[model samples]
Target: MLRDLSRPIETGMPTYPGDPDVTLAPDATHGADGYATSRFRTGTHAGTHVDAPRHTLPEGEAIDERDVGEFAFDARLVDLRPLEQREAIAPEALPDPGAIDDDVDLLLLRTGWASHWGSDRYRDHPYLTAATAERCRAADVGVGLDAFGPDPTPTARGDTESPASDGDEPDGTPAHDVLLGDSLPIVENLCGLDDLPTRFRLYAFPLRLRGGDGSPVRAAAEWDD
Candidate 1:
């Protein structure tokens, strides 16, 4: 059976704080243009999307430059629900790395945050700590989460400041750095993971836009009963 793991991208859908809001307004109607079409305007990272290395590293490979095989892989899902709001997930929050098959290239975490997708609470969902990213990197698996991003909410860090001055390393984005630095793609805003088994095959190909930092993906998974 195949289960769609993508979040529906529609008007007023929840988006990252700085990202543009989704707008799916009709541009052509059957009576006017003899066809039905809608105009879509949103950030590339909107909704269920993949993050390429260029999302963090300046010299990193863009979405189109990476191998197509990177997006499809053996996946394992682990539940980390009941995690407190704004909590930073630790390595212990995941199952033992040894329990995962060596061929498992993707590790998806179900944080139960998808239930709050359209509310302000979605911004406060739990995120992975740097240690958790390290663990995933060590296990040689890409990461996916059902939250806004992989890092904790910026407000939770008690710093309301914007990006630091030039030549200063930005803080509070280690999860992206660690995983992307290793050239591993991250899929965020994934839904329907709760319906998947512990092990499945994932196919999440992004738009092949040249030099694109990232692209929204229609992530899905399939497994045998």
Candidate 2:
């Protein structure tokens, strides 16, 4: 079976704190121009997007610099749902190394947070700790999630302050630091994991935007019936 794992790009879709707001405007009317085109302005990370090493590491590789094969993921979905608001996803929540297959190159975290995609609660979605990101790095796998990012997002829109709760404070973008620091891709704003099998093939190739720190992708997944 095949399923789309991407969030549709539209005007006014929720974006990360301080990121550019998305806009889609008609550039030419069908009646006037006899052809249609649109003018869209959006941040590279807006909507369902992938993060490249350049997203965090100043010396890291941009999305267009990496080999396209890396974007095709041999993915494993790990469920960690029912978490509390703004909860941290600790390393222990991941499956043991023994349970992982050598063929897996990406780990998609299912926190059941996609249900809150457009609400304020979406920003409060569960997040991965630096430790969890380290685990994925050591395991040689990239990270994906149903929420905004692997790191805790600020609950308020346009707030750039790092999130703090229960006495744990992440250095800004720690998960991105650990993962992208190593050139591992981070996919975010994914949806429909609840309908996918544990193991699947994921394709989320980004546009060949030269020197792009990141890019929005048409992410999709497929699994044997």
Collision pairs in model 2: none
| Residue-level lDDT tens digits of model 1 in 79-137 | 88788777778898876778778999888888999888876677777878788888888
lDDT scores in order: 0.84, 0.88
TM-scores, each model vs. reference: 0.90, 0.94
- Candidate 2's C-alpha runs over 4 A off are 157-166
Q: Give a tens-digit lDDT track for model 2, residues 1-225.
A: 778989999999999988999999899989999999999999999989999899988889988899999999999989887798788888899976667899998999999999988877788788888988888888888989999999887667354542446657575899899998888879999998886888999999999999999999999998888
Tell how far residue 158 is off in model 2, in angstroms: 10
> RMSDs, each prediction?
4.4, 2.4
Candidate 2 to truth, TM: 0.94
